[model samples]
Target: MSGPLVSIIIPFYNDGYVNQAVASALAQTYPHIEVIVVDDGSTANQHLLDPYRSRIHYIGKANGGTASALNYGIRMATGEYIAWLSSDDIFYPHKVAGQLGHMLSRGALISSTDFDLIGAHGELLKPQLAVKFASAADFLRALHTFCPINGCTVMMHRSVIGRIGWFDESLRYTQDYDYWLRVILSGIDFHFVNSPLTAYRWHDKSGTSRYLDQVNAEFGIVHGRYVHGLNGLIARIGG
Candidate 1:
């Protein structure tokens, strides 16, 4: 099969470190890739993105949260496959080539690869599995146990978005987790590449770390939306 067009969507809010992330996408070994950077009403260091303006498709909108930014990016995407990258994360050179090759070869709707955790100083912390689920049921079973999927490492077919709809704009956190639940429950096939293809950065100011309580609350909301009322509540509590 011919290679597919890959769309890399990034949502950022005043993240000065976004250059590395944008560079990662632009440097993908794969040639047919489009990089979309959505700035979520960030006023701090807006010039941080000026260097990449000519290389990437940039959008600036009011701060409506990551989900809203992502949804906007999705609507504007014209590729056969869509992937997301957090503003602080970095994709390895072959991330797009490897994940796209695997997804096309396997005819899978959703695919992800392992990634390395990077510290603020750009040191590798550890490697992590990119693929968290082998099937729909497995994903649902592990939903509350742990978040198996990583947003930045995921690459999925455009049809998956068509069927599952866009990310939940109402969620402040766990939006990707919520989207994964919807994808799996909708019976889409999931696949994985075991190689570490990206760098997931963990910093003091990162969204996941800065908003733990909000993240927990959003997690509960996702669980309730997918796992039914009583069972989902139990799972969230048990988790």
Candidate 2:
């Protein structure tokens, strides 16, 4: 750990894959970083994390949704920037260095990279789908139909959190999409790096797979908050 402090916050439950998640963060090529793991009330498998006790800041909290766990970690983060990793996902070794460099070069408050999709056994699933937003207006336009950013691929400045505020605890499934939409809507630019910097695990046990119906329903509620608002935003940006 060598440059500016970057906080890698991993929120997990009883998933056995968590060790890989923390290991990926620990192996980041970036020199300076702090790894914080928030255990969201796991009933068992606590022993898996024992080996990393001295290597990370661990917090065990009562069973709450992912949104709650993330907010707790963000509040406790002491880094200039934050990088979130899912318990089952893996970050490319160059993830932090690559995204941080892009943010600094583009003067962006938040940035996300393209990512590869992997199977439960770490087998390649598919190449990354490209995500690009010319401006906030473009992002909002797309949100009318789909989420344009991957939450795990994000590396955002600490002040970006201050500007946009924390994740909405009320949003149980689509919280990340809701948060990203809010970030760009707050007049802070969101940038993208074309390089793939993370491996997105697509296992059946992943939240989306287990709660597809809930996520879809929650998306309706979340996107509604932007429908009328996006029209005004587009007008202001001359889009």
Cα-based lDDT for every prediction: 0.83, 0.88
Worst 10 residues of 2 by lDDT: 129-138
Per residue, candidate 1 scores C-alpha lDDT tens digits across 1-239 of 45789999999898878988898899988999999999899988668778889989999899999999999998888899999999999999999988888887888889777889899978988877354555545555777655777888899888887798988888888888888877765656567688899899998998889988888887887777676743553354463
**lDDT tens digits, residues 1-239, model 2?**
35679999999899889998999999988989999999999987778889998999999999888999999999999999999999899999999999998888888878888999999999998878556666766766888888878899999889887778899998888889899878767777778889999999998888899999889999999888987777778888887
TM-scores for candidates 1 onward, in order: 0.90, 0.95
Alpha-carbon RMSD, candidate 1: 3.9
Give candidate 2 regions above 4 Å deviation.
132-138
Best by lDDT: 2
Worst 10 residues of 1 by lDDT: 230-239
